[model samples]
Target chain A: MSNQSLVDAEWALSHLDDAKVVFIEVDEDTEAYAGNHIKNAIALNWKTDLQDPIRRDFVNKEQFEALLSAKGVSNDDTVVLYGGNNNWFAAYAFWYFKLYGHSDVRLLDGGRKKWELDGRELVSDVPSRAATKYVAKDQDLSIRSFREDVLKAIGTQNLVDVRSPDEYAGRLLAPAHLPQEAARIGGHIPTAANIPWSKAANEDGSFKSIDELKALYEGAGVDLNKDTIAYCRIGERSAHSWFVLHELLGVKNVSNYDGSWTEYGSLVGVPVAVGDEPGTA
Target chain B: MSGCGAVVGGVSLDNVDITNQAVIQGVISSGNAPASVGYARLLDRNDEFVAEVPISKQGEFRFFTVAGDWTIVALIPGANSRTPVQATIGKILDVDIAVIK
Candidate 1:
């Protein structure tokens, strides 16, 4: 079934009771999240919840299960996540849940920004006393990516870079933004495509509709039917990109680079890209 | 006053300069720090609120210093809560509220 866009905060909040929706906040800085967030929303820091210190790969599954359980999430719950102002962090959580085999997951379109913009109410009282029991299927590897999968993904699934062209071009970069060694090891994967993250949105954080999204991907040389991997600085922005691919555009086989440029670029002996130049058609 | 913008972690901070101490302010939702409504704190250059604001039932918080770069930080009980608070800064910026409606 096509997922309804969570762009309208009130409309999404209205459905909170029908699903086990969780409002999340992911940010470059926590300054915004602390000011106030959507009511009953539990906050998950990207550094803490989504990633382990190792970078790129999924953290231990049991650790993830504990974090999920603490947030009142359960296997049966339909997880609706949001981060910062828009669906970025929500997409991160969406990717994580799916990687862990949580069947139903979605993003709150426009995320907190839209929710607050719509003038919906927010309270910090996360008073849900009921701790739902969450049982991992142990081998439910239905939604995650591994190092080998990404290594083998070259020339298989189209790798889509959601980062800005400057980033893709290898200009205007921070020392810590990406792995220093990535440039020498490799450039864009052989057949990877470049579709900057902003392309998915309409200036505002709200995303373009499915039809528009479909066209955007097609125009960028991506085939919705085949495999695709979305990536950005860390896994967060790419997670948002993947959300659009899977949820809005209805792409079947899509995954995000959990290690992303940081980990992948740092590998001692991987191929690297140089300059803002496109590799090859 | 020049707003204290974020020093690190933003890939592209909308270029709005949100980390200034004058442009933002916040409250800690869960803590024994003894904060109350209308209570406000002055943010250091690092963009952290040294004091706490007592949250109003309506969650409306107004620091004495407005119309400058500032961010409001809510002191939630948990340690990790401080980092995720959404912050913004501009010539005409806003402080987010957790008002109880």
Candidate 2:
């Protein structure tokens, strides 16, 4: 289903007339991104620029649009999003753009690690200057998942978790960078599936092809045709799943949970599924 | 919500989530030579501890969820783990630390 699943580092290097998109590495420290990055990739502070605690959600529409314009993202630019792991933040950026009406976007299959590991070049501290107008078409809820849908889909649809074993088990915890309780009250979704995001990539950080990817999903006992919903910490990692299912597997009925665990795990009341150390139901 | 420990790379995590987990990955370099390494967790941002982790055979170090947003300063101890060697911290944000050797 991929027009081209693996967008090589060289493509990114050679295709750019000017570094238009910014690579936002989300963490507590800026030193690393400051040291070296994807040339024009700006270090986006997720907390400061991405989310606003006061609103308890992604920034408001005007603010969000302004933020995009401030970042120099325009309506027609084809953006490439990526980050450290599954390019989670990059996926978030992708989701943000799509949510606000932009669609010409894609994620760097392996992200910074893959790029760096492959001996691709790196850029440090120099600010990239390329400005364009990013416009919003509509908040396509179709591309995103909501708690209500997740709650309704609990038994009806399948929830595919791209996190690790610890996360699936109540014993392991995901880091919630919010002002609320960050731990899960229960374990995974009822009778849900677990397929760590890293599995999509090989040891070297390149994505597997349609055959290899299909083999991976089938090996996990996951049925792509069923009603499926993907979720991760804040929906960042899951967006990768959305891309994989839709773009790779051609799986329809796929949605990504926007609130993800941050809201679900912190809720004072919800239908939670706990585990007995994660092995039993 | 996320249940993964911490992403060793990327920024702006000044607090820990009580309900979820995340992952953090990075390399500890010596001068210009990147090496696998580990350090003690400073639960409190201001305190230091005597904990050392042998870098994985792959030359990487990680922390499960001692606390989010807790700064990872080079802890070479007598060698200055906070030494300033010009290594990228991760993707979160950027900083330059000059550890006193």
Candidate 3:
């Protein structure tokens, strides 16, 4: 069950020309793939292609179907996703694929970072596949959570704020590079554990060993047995954590709060806890 | 909704005016060549990760942060290095990191 959702560079390299497999790159720097990418890989902009144009939510089922169809991704193809920033956006897309009930989807371990670091060949040639009549299922809501679920889980479930410590402590509203006006207030949900998503990744951008991952969360006071919800300012980073907890560790009940702090912190009358401590109820 | 993080990979700030911003910017290189494929990470005083961005094709990276002591770590193929700098408001600090393979 553990290695079922991940593939290494070697496996991916050997299958570069496999007709039954598709490689998709979803990068944080949206432009990364354009510079160079794995042979025959297609690019999916996490913002434009995946998200709904007017709504704050993801694309509807029909839209997803059209997207994959245009990308020539068949329902039976094995989709392997990779990206920059330790596969942050890639994992987010992986969650989206799972939400739409796509089977046989997996992540490229370490993603673009590892691919480049290993001195692997990345070609600028883009390949085109004939469009397929893609079909998508209703969103699997079990893996996704809304602000209400977050509020309800407060002090009851294992709520994990997978942002930088500064963000969790209210020292900064958002990451240092981005604008600081994402939320009306700054701080994390009460009784939430602050475990930055970067902890699950190595300096080289690959995920740590399974034993290391288990110890990292358990050492951070995240009860593995409890139903857990992971959140970041937006959802991508938390999706990485959700992948770790749910897919990698085989946790029975884990969800990613896509609305995250922007929705939760902006909600009026809801309690917000500042400082380094995970405040009590 | 607005995007959450900056667009990375071969980004150029040549036209960006950082006149009044506290910025930590640099070019990453190994030996005599630019380390074009990699990521640059900004770490706080406590050595905790703050943010990361993919380096430009020209091996450039930048971070707009509060004026303070910070460390910049470059993760590239066959090489990695960290450099410390003290940033000040209204001024740009350039710290070029040379990774040894």
Candidate 4:
């Protein structure tokens, strides 16, 4: 099935009890889910659930299958994800699921923030369902990028740094208030463009209009025809941008550099440019 | 404020001037304590809440500040009291928070 990238709160509400639909809440703060979350929603921890504890990368395929199976998520189920931080962790989960070849995942547009702001129902009660075996395909590398790929794309201008201007300029490594998405050094990959990830959303945490989105990216010289790699401090924010570009805008060759600035900025001998602008080589 | 109006990290660029600031990045973990939910509060030297964000499952957190020393306290869910962690920032600082349970 061709996955619909975004679903509204009302749609999610109506489908909450549907057998074919499963609701998952991905949050950085693992305790947020336990406090009060959408009824029947299972929580996915952005850190422990998504990553391999022994490695710096994601969990392997067996672990992925087991996690889904334990959560009662079968291969054919349509997974709906929503969470805190404007769905930052949700988008990251969306990307992670897609990486493991799940084809029917969708994001709850505006996430938990909008749901709470709109006075939607939230329950502390958890749901338990009989576990189902989930068969996962191999990881899809096409939607993910590595540091080497970013290095090769230097000067091509297709790499987009979705961090703030100060972080992009080397004036700051990250926002003083947002240290969770920080790196060791400030600046951006050479030849990349600075298009802050938040531009894709509206004041209410919902996405901007389609025309507005097209104009926003086009204004930044991000042509949809060519391959594009979007990155932020780590990867969650950039996954939001990736969802906008690849899913909403239907751009063909967009990938999230999940390693992002955390990896690119810490590497030795990798060229980086500092200034308000993304200078070319 | 004089640049093309762009929204950055949920704030409008027209309002924020980041010409000079320091960044502090770190992960907050309790050595053997169970993972807790909630946010970490960034405090000034006088112990005021300057800013806060939810702590990650891996205990990751970040903060941006002017050039100076600062302190933070974990606001984990179901925990009695959180010990304060400290850091100093010039341009950038990496200080991991290991909460004393």
Candidate 5:
């Protein structure tokens, strides 16, 4: 039940004054941090800070380095990320941190939802820190997957589509709240397991125990022993699952396909399986 | 990056175009004033988690759903509430949730 990749509210509260720990909030709603946040925590807009303005990919390593440097994060600082919507974008940022080879990154368990539900203190005051010269390593391709990788892993690896059942079943192209026209078609990648990412989380927005997570994935026929790639509409949700498998469960070979269904379901002549079942490869 | 960007919800109904869409939208309030902070979660008919969006400073939340029975759960600090809603296409359903501390 111990995970080095996560810290609870108690741990976060105790570390509020820790010079070596940096609390970063990455919310799906970028404005959440402005209204109120955990004291001394800074905000990283998942939309602007993490994404490339022109391309569909993330910001380059230099951008990432400059971002951390501006945020006063040193190479040795332990970065703890948390956000709203069960830390969906926080996990995305965590995966991005890992992709850039940052060694001491962790997620704040339950994120803003759990913190607010617990009646924890949140403040609107922002903190300022001296800028540091931050360095980022090259992208770690091992923890990331491309469209070709997903196509090749159809029958060989465990492809877990972490969208809701309706999305997986081709009934909805995107989440209910989002515009439904992101992809040209609905349905899931062929042979992908339809294990919704929400299953790994609790009602209070905290992640489930390791045993429960393992059981949930295994019950969905996801083979943990095999190389795994998790995807959602745009990869944020799958990053939550990626955090669970690779960080919490200690799975060695897991990747988050950032392009996800937005790329896969829209590609010309790519295999897409419709209906409730996981279609054949 | 069509669906890749963040969807900032909690917008006033005036900003949303509900044309040809089945919408479940609302505002969160406590003591007759807009709740400043909270999240509105959408649950399917079976009570399974569907999606979640942060409430705006104005305490607004909107969901573009298909015609069906759904439950909206408001998670506000020190207070929480849920309301069942039935949505039909080409119509907008407004359900205000009142939470108390």
Candidate 6:
């Protein structure tokens, strides 16, 4: 069954004080929330709230439940997410909530940028809610792929590398200025096709229309009927594509390789292909 | 383990004048809300990418660099506020900075 996908800023503003609706800003930098945020919004950092601190993975079911409970979110509450970086991180968090079976989640259309551009109000007043127990469902593994899963799908023509052209071709380790985000090596997993994540979004940081998204993926040879796996340097960008294909375009069998290039690149033994030098593989 | 030295990999963090290198660390604030997943980018004076690190769970992030006057910008995933702070990297640099959102 498909979930309701997006909520516009107008819808969000009207429901600011709804008891069963929770607005969550999943930003990379926590500081953004402290200064000014959507009124009655609670903050969830993609790293600390969602990630497994001890491991390079998402938090466990218990951790996820605790986070929501502590944040006053009940399983019945509608969780709405938005962020700064064109909603890539927000989309990643959206994918996380979905994997854990939160069925009522929605992404804020155009994210925080569109909201602000329209002259919406932001506040520094922190509102407290009565905490409720949160129940987390078992993770749906079909939507998340690990390294072993990626290995099994190698050379299958459905593994999509959703990074920039430079990253796909190994022209740069990471964004030149963002060196700390680089992987141990350059290049993508063997047999993965290059389909940068930015292509799925409009210039305004909102997703493209459904027809446009469908054509974009089909043009990239992403078969909606077949099992597809998407990856990026750190899995966040790929998650954006994952949302576009699976949620927006109605692709049924897509999985996000959260380990992505960072894990794959650091591996000791795996087939890697750099795209710039054709036939190098 | 919270500074640039602890963020190791992709580049060799070695051979700095032990007395001259400093650590830049701080919370990436939006307002009173702090974030844990964004990055702090260290750019050369010419606006070139030098290095970046993810913000920590406690809303803190860091970078290690040699003594120099550098520009540091905070980046959140969807925001494009590029309000950068001019940081002087010396023996030890402690800063409280914000990400332009």
lDDT score of residue B50 within candidate 5 = 82
Each candidate's DockQ score against the native complex? 0.05, 0.08, 0.52, 0.10, 0.48, 0.07
User: What digit string (tens of lDDT, one per residue) describes model 1 on residues B1-101?
Assistant: 11111222212324433333123333333233323322223343345322222334333333322233333444222221223233233322344434222
TM-score of each: 0.65, 0.70, 0.94, 0.75, 0.93, 0.73
User: Model 5 chain B, TM?
Assistant: 0.85
Model number with the top DockQ: 3
Tell me the TM-score of candidate 2's A chain.
Answer: 0.84
Q: Could you tally the backbone clashes for each prediction? A: 53, 70, 2, 12, 1, 24
Cα error of candidate 2 at position A34, Å: 1.7
Candidate 1, A25-92: lDDT as tens digits: 66544555666767666677765566665643456678777777776777877666776524556677
- Residue-level lDDT of model 6, residues B9-84, one tens digit each, is 1122354332433555567677667764455656655554445454555557556544455666665556534435
* Local accuracy of candidate 6 as per-residue lDDT tens digits, A35-107: 7789999999877788788978789999999999999998988999997666777889899999999979899
**What residue runs in model 6 are displaced by over 4 Å at the alpha carbon?**
A1-3, A180-183, A277-281, B1-101
C-alpha lDDT of residue A181 in model 1 = 25
The candidate with the higher TM-score, 4 or 6, is: 4
Cα lDDT of model 4 by residue, B1-101, tens digit: 01111111122123344445456555666656433344555555544335445555566665666565566665443332344544444444666556564
What DockQ number belongs to candidate 4? Answer: 0.10
DockQ of 6: 0.07
Give the clash total for candidate 3: 2
Error of 3 at B53 (Å): 1.5
Q: What is candidate 4's lDDT per residue for A27-137, written digit by digit as tens?
A: 866667887899899998888788888767899999999999998999999999998776778988998999999979999987876676566788999999679999898
**Full ranking by TM-score:** 3, 5, 4, 6, 2, 1
**TM-score of chain A in every predicted structure:** 0.82, 0.84, 0.97, 0.95, 0.98, 0.94
